[model samples]
Target: MIQDITTSIRTTVVLWLLTALIYPLLILVIGQGIFPAQANGSLIVNDQGQVIGSTLIGQAFSSEEYFWSRPSAVDYSIGEAAAPTGLSGATNLAPSNPDLLALTEERAEILQAANIAPTADLLYSSGSGLDPHISPASAIAQIDRIAAVRNLSLDDLQTLITQNTEGRFLGIFGEPAVNTVTLNLSLDQR
Candidate 1:
């Protein structure tokens, strides 16, 4: 019937406007007004005020002087040619997969070569492949290497780690983690 068709079209338009435009605009205004830094990617800046990176994403740090982040399946490429297609996610390789085993072994070998024992977070890429935080244990495990490379005392480095460690959400949720990006930046300052 014509009435039914008219009602249906009107309902569709109202719902579309609410979801596709008005709702998102409301959220944007609220976000920008309430949390401007987080609304704009939570970017970290250097002493010169250049945008170095975002706190929400991980970056690869191969330097022995810095604490490393979790291994990323995408190698932390956002739009680079290395990972032009996607930004995050696991390799999805099963534990029994030969490629997974080989990669794990290779990571283990690299850690052993550096005299640093590999932790779970170091050996395996996180599910998102973009986790910026590493386990407290992982950060502690690298203190000796970082201290040696940076010519800083081990006790000083340990203190820095303690200072930078972020506690769990509401003191109950996820495990404590250290933001490697922030930790490295703090090291640079020191």
Candidate 2:
């Protein structure tokens, strides 16, 4: 009985130290050394060195002159949260839910008011509610509005969008998408 108890305690302690201490320390060391920028949250900076947002996260841009992120479940005035999937959650509403329909209608009206064609991406919340990218088709649909509002040529805006769009991983995985915050930033720098 005594030997069994001693062996059990030793096993528990060994596993605890390995998992709770050494494992995390090892991962942190490897992460910091191998990918310092990403380890530091993939933050982005501007010309004056001010931290703006991150490449891996989304932010809301409702201004006519800027492109907007997909509708976030976590709605707020400042718009989308900056941190990767920060404070995100789905409304978990079923497709036929009346509240969902109402919200979609409201969003459609808002887009119509701006003369922008509303797409599914505009009406639905992303699974993560923090997706940093949107379908290229969705981005394209808003080009006219952005062009008119920014007083920039449609050709230029389309070119800019094309430049920022990314193909799927290894050119064959998911559909092409455009980073919302990055596109807006690129627009500003131009």
Candidate 3:
């Protein structure tokens, strides 16, 4: 019984050190060395060298001149940076729920007031509520409004949208979508 107890103690200590210390340290060093930008959080900077947002996270854009991301349930009242702003979750409201229908109608009216026909996606939030990307169709749906507000040509805006549109992963998995944050950043360049 003493021998068994001793062996268990020794094994536990060895495994704990390997998992809690050595393994994590090795991974951190390797990750930082191989992918510094990503390891550092994939931050995006503006022309003045201010951190704007991260490529891996979504930020809210409400300006008519800017392309908008999916409606994030996360509150941005906490900070200037949009990433890591608030907890992400869904409405979880059913299709027939009055609240869901009311929210959709409200969103549609907002777009219509701007004279843009909101797409189906624009009416509903994404699953994560943190999705930075929107379907190309959704982006295209708002082009006219954005162009009007920004005083840019429709053709140029269309070209910009086309340029930012990302195909499905390996042309198979996931749907084709455009990162609205990145797209708006590019628009700022214009």
Candidate 4:
């Protein structure tokens, strides 16, 4: 019995050492070297060089002059930088779901108040609650409101949106999207 206990302890020590120290250290070094930006959380900085947020996560914006990001269910309460809980999902509530119906009505009311057209992206949240981009249609839906609020012409805002819109991964894997952080930063510059 003692011999078996001693052997188990030795195996545990070896496994723990490898898992808790050596393997993590090796992965960190490799990750830092190969994917520095992602390793650093894909942070976004401003002209003042202040770190605003990460390009990988979405933030809520309620104003009219800025382009809004997707609805984030995370709420950033536990900690803004913490890995969001899996519960932070887009309700997945169907159109007929009472909660979804209420939310859609509220969103539609907001769009009407802003004199803007509503899009599907604006009405729902993404699965991860951390999408950093909006569909081009969603962005375009808000152009009139943003333009009117910023006192900029619709044509100019459209140009800005066009410039900020990014194509798919190597033109195939993912859909095109506009980065809300970049778009809002550009608005601040203007």
**Each model's TM-score?**
0.91, 0.86, 0.87, 0.77
Number of colliding residue pairs in each model: 0, 0, 0, 0
* lDDT tens per residue, model 2, 52-92: 88887778788888987789887622434535534867789
Q: Can you tell me which runs of candidate 4 are displaced by over 4 Å? A: 1-22, 76-87, 92-96
Candidate 3 regions off by >4 Å?
76-85
Instruction: Give per-residue CA lDDT, model 3, range 72-162, as digits (tens).
Output: 6553223655445456677899999999888889988987897767886677787777777888888888888888788999899889888
lDDT string, candidate 1, 1-190, tens digits: 9999999999999999999999999999999999999999999998789999988888999988889889999888755655545578899999999999999999999988888889999999999999889888988888888878889998998888888888999999999999888888899999
**Better candidate by TM-score, 2 or 4:** 2
Ranking by lDDT: 1, 2, 3, 4
Per-residue lDDT, model 2, residue 35, is 91
Candidate 1 CA-lDDT value:
0.90
- Candidate RMSDs in Å, in order, are 1.9, 3.1, 2.7, 3.9
Give residue 35's lDDT in candidate 4 (0 to 100). 91
Q: Model 3, residue 159: displacement in angstroms?
A: 2.5
By TM-score, who's the top model here?
Answer: 1
Q: Rate the local accuracy (lDDT) of all candidates.
A: 0.90, 0.85, 0.81, 0.81
